[model samples]
Target: MITSLDHLVLTVADIDATIAFYTQALGMTHAPFTVADGSTRHALRFGESKINLHVSGAEFEPKAQNPTAGSADLCFLTDRPLADWQRHLAAHGTRIEEGPVPRSGATGPLISLYVRDPDGNLIEISAPLQP
Candidate 1:
């Protein structure tokens, strides 16, 4: 059985812009590592999770059947308050597509805000509802 997600890949249109958005807008850390073919690849790290980046047409082996940008809708849980996140996002000039609306998370109730990354991927940042 699967325990947890080690990492996931995102087929990005532009790696640099994706990195900048995730890093500056979302406050994730950017790390570059060498692949088996000795080429450098980028990843964004947050908590214990990481998202690897691959160019649109230049994906690594064993990739998704249709690795297209803007096709993903990812939700991330945050301990910080939604208000704080909103301010932070505003400071970064990131637009919130939706509000702190109620939603069901993988574990329990959650309030989430939606935003779009540079690649147009729907990014949901949520905080658990303290019922």
Candidate 2:
């Protein structure tokens, strides 16, 4: 059985833009690392969690079952409030795809703000509601 999610892969239409959006808007750091095949992969790291970016159309082994850009819908929990995420997105000229609405998180209640990355991937930024 799985204990927790370690990392996830995102097939990106544009790797540079994806890196910029996550690093600049979401406060994540870009960590470029090389695989065993001597190819480099771009990733965004926040603490122990990370999201690896694979350029669409590039050949890579051991990938997602459905590795299509803009196909993933993911939620990220933050200690910062939804308002903060909203502000960051607005400042970066990133449009809110949905809203800062109430939503149910996997472990608890949450308030989430939705946005689309350059690849049009649905990104849900969430803050946990106080118990």
Candidate 3:
């Protein structure tokens, strides 16, 4: 049986820039050893889950790869509610696509917001499930 999620992989063009975005902007720390892997891997700590970033190549641009922008979506859990996430994103000028809506799924009702990284990969920030 599946216990919990370990991490999610994200392909980026600029590994160093992505690392800085996660570490500086998103408040994630770079895991050691990954830096020496040569693929420019980095992991951001999210509770017990980690967000893994992999450098594909110089020509690897997310926007170019994901035109529909629906290949994959990543979610982040925050202690604050949807309103807080909205404010934080606005303060940082993060793009919001579809979100903060009560989504119907296995997890029940959850509020979510969407944003993209510097590489133009769609990422989501979500508040804990609430009725």
Candidate 4:
């Protein structure tokens, strides 16, 4: 039914911090966008999906008070999935809980690993074989 994972949204406390963490730590480039209100959202491009981090100054209170961890898992296409993640995470001091598992689901078979972002949100890095 689903063609591919398009994007994932995350509500974070520190917008710049989250941006820096993903850009510097995970090697993602912040893509350009338009912000309608004073509130803003950042889109970082990593392979196919764009990880979005939104900031809504005081309008949304729940995200500021209570944050969710590992609510969503994201994957990136890489030539060396495991090695690239290992070096990147190590350089940024991010620890891996579990990893590099061969997942089987509707998305098909893929090699993946899991990690958390600055706000403790879970992320997956997967390399899907050619169809």
Residue-level lDDT tens digits of model 2 in 42-100: 88998788998888988377887778998989988899877777887889898888877
TM-score of 3: 0.71
Give the clashing pairs for model 1.
none
lDDT of 4 by residue, 28-118 (tens): 8988576665655468888777866665443333353543533556555566658777877888888876777887644577777778777
TM-score of each: 0.97, 0.92, 0.71, 0.69
Rate residue 88 of model 3 by lDDT: 67
Clashing pairs in 3: 100-112
Better candidate number, 2 or 4, judged by lDDT: 2
Give a tens-digit lDDT track for model 1, residues 38-97.
988899999999999989999988999999988989999999999999999999999999
Which is the better candidate, 2 or 4, if ranked by TM-score? 2
lDDT of 3 by residue, 11-100 (tens): 676778777766755667888443333644456776777766555543323324543322456666667777776776677666678787
Query: Which ten contiguous residues of candidate 4 have the minimum total lDDT?
Result: 56-65
Clashes of 3: 1
Q: Kindly indicate the candidate among 3 and 4 with the higher TM-score.
A: 3
Model 2, 51: alpha-carbon shift in Å? Answer: 1.0
